[model samples]
Target: MNYAKEARDLDFAYKVRHALNESAENLPVATLDRLASARAIALSRKKQEAPAVALAFRGILAGNTGLSFQGPTSWLGKFGVVLPLLVLVMGLFGIYEYEQQQRINDLAEIDVAVLADELPPDAYLDTGFSAFLNKEEE
Candidate 1:
């Protein structure tokens, strides 16, 4: 879509330039000379355009080049990058600890339930007891 639009714009520019050239050829010599002089003056007075430069970390890190990041705010910039990573590490550690605690609590609950039951603990180890419980479920 963009390519087609660009092609149309380029075609329109070429047609306009061709029309201008055709009309300019029919103009009087004096008028052509005045236009030429005006064009030359405009070109001569035009400021030299600065080269386009891309922003890069290499430029910032190196103190001598383009824009320097070595001033008072340099530590702040480093801290900005470090702070998020510190937070992520701490968050992950916290999540891990929370999961570990949940698993321990779940095991403790199961142990307490079994201990509180009226049946002898040895009955749980009997294969017949397990079969009887399965049958009871049916």
Candidate 2:
């Protein structure tokens, strides 16, 4: 991960490419023209097939053309980011509310059971009562 070494390597590669390009000019005129044509064709094909989302970024330089969203595309992009976070917060809130309701329902059921039984009210406070309720629930 040495950036200096990478920069030096890149510079060396560029020089090598320059030298090769210079040597390539010495090739036959027909060969050079064919090579240029092939390069142009390859670049055109690559550009046509490139994904839009991958290029949904600002230009490489200050004002070059790439994907720049406007109107609905811009709104959709912003909404795309916000929608998931909103859903997550709402989902968590719902789960917490559901849990609270369930706890309340369980307590209400216990209260009804204690009221409906024939046992004395004092027996409800006995330690065994809790265990008996657990066994009943199971």
Candidate 3:
């Protein structure tokens, strides 16, 4: 009564049955019958141990349920996952907006020569600091 040998034989039979069933369309009738018998034996053994397996899965689910958030600890607790993400997103947006504003301001203060190279001379002809000051006086 070699337990290891018996286990090996059972495992081999299970593998053969699983393979045969997977390729049932191509399998011979005799081989299908043997595979079916092997599968039945394996299923019966599994059925006998089903309760223990079910209990094990139940224990796992119970443990996981406890680990999941019970409820908000306080009003702010609801923001635990959201608060950090919101802060990160807002910070990025703020930085982008600040950089854009800075670029616009820098472009506004660019030298006339640099502006002339980028824009037509006629566009800036009547737009100068003195004109701006005259407008302020008005």
Candidate 4:
């Protein structure tokens, strides 16, 4: 069935090509010249297509996968993916460092409070000290 369909398509294409060729020969020289000039102009204005990989990778930074990547701005597209990831990693590292510094500061404050207390450090080691403090709170 597929072979029959393909044969019919091929036959139709041949017929159409023959018809166009026959008609093209009968066209006026002036009309043909105009057509040739028009074809040249159209071809000149036509955009050159990039390779398959270039097309897929092009303008990806701008969320446009269809447009071709041009010369100087091509680097911008390539850097687009890496830039955001680099920034994210840097931001995360900064947040981690800030948290670590804050934790160290909190520990330092606790140490300073302990050292500045009026009670002797030995009193804190006593098992009864907690019980005495709880009783005093009552």
Candidate 5:
């Protein structure tokens, strides 16, 4: 359905009602004449515009009489819908793996530092050592 056409018609009706309400009292002859002239001018312009716009639409419809979307178009539309979802899942998995690798690398680095420092194995169990490791990380 053409929603814009319906909305434009409704808007014109609303404006007409509002104008009628505002002009409920009798107006002066000059004001009425000026309004009549303005209405005639506007109606003439609308008549000129309506035919051209209508014929333009008719011409477009006539030209594209055979154009249609089906078969491959339907397949492509489905692929378009699924491709983004597949890409999103793969991207998330890749990010997850990257973060996991980074965490592993961090732990390995901490292990290597402790080995290099030749700390006693007892130091690993000490609560203070945990704080020392965190401070070093900072």
Candidate 6:
């Protein structure tokens, strides 16, 4: 019995088992199995373990830490509040602009009346060449 090879195989199996257990504690069993197989293959190919182990640890911590305990009033809930406020602000601004346009149109009509009164009496006379030609032809 070659003890060295047996020990190496046992160590590899242990690491794979550890990874699988961590994943299962966090995610579903199928995800755990997939992660375990990938890690085992990577280890068999002599790839690095630091990044993979760190990620697995983070996943386990996130799962066990209960970070999602803040019910509906989390980040998403604030948006529910802010969105309606934004819509109301936009509606008010739209109404203000419409009223402003109506006021400007009314003021324009007043300006037209003032201009008519300010012009001289001769300004209304048709003194252009077309008018002269029309009078001559008539």
User: What TM-scores do the predictions have?
Assistant: 0.51, 0.41, 0.30, 0.45, 0.46, 0.33
Error of 3 at 111 (Å): 6.1
Please name the candidate that would achieve the greatest TM-score relative to the true structure: 1
Model 5 lDDT per residue over 1-138, tens place = 599999999999999999997885568888888988999998887744443433343323344333343222455545877889999999999999999999999999988887888677689999998999899999
- Which run of 10 residues does model 6 get worst, by summed lDDT? 57-66
Pairs in clash, predicted candidate 6: none
TM-score, model 5 to reference: 0.46
Q: Which prediction has the highest lDDT against the true structure?
A: 1
lDDT, candidate 1, residue 65? Answer: 33
- Candidate 3 residue 128 C-alpha distance from true site, Å: 25
Tens-place lDDT digits, model 4, residues 1-138: 999999999999999999999999999999999999999999999999985764454433555544446423466666876789999999999999999999999999987987899988788889899899999999
Q: Residue 16, candidate 3: how far off, in angstroms?
A: 57
> What's the CA RMSD of model 6 in angstroms?
18.3
- All models: lDDT? 0.87, 0.81, 0.73, 0.84, 0.78, 0.74
- Model 3: residues >4 Å from true position, as ranges? 1-78, 111-138
- Enumerate residue pairs that collide in model 5: none
Model 2, 27-121: lDDT tens digits are 99999899999999988877456555655435333544335552324655568778899999999999999999999999999989978989977
> On a 0 to 100 scale, what is the lDDT of residue 103 in model 2?
100
Give, for candidate 1, the lowest lDDT window spanning 10 residues. Answer: 63-72
Name the regions of candidate 5 deviating beyond 4 angstroms: 1-42, 45-73, 127-138
lDDT (Cα, 0-100) at 66 in candidate 1: 30
lDDT (0-100) at residue 15 of candidate 3? 100
Number of colliding residue pairs in model 3: 0
Kindly report the root-mean-square deviation of model 2 from the true structure over all alpha carbons: 11.6
- Ordered from best to worst lDDT, the candidate numbers read 1, 4, 2, 5, 6, 3
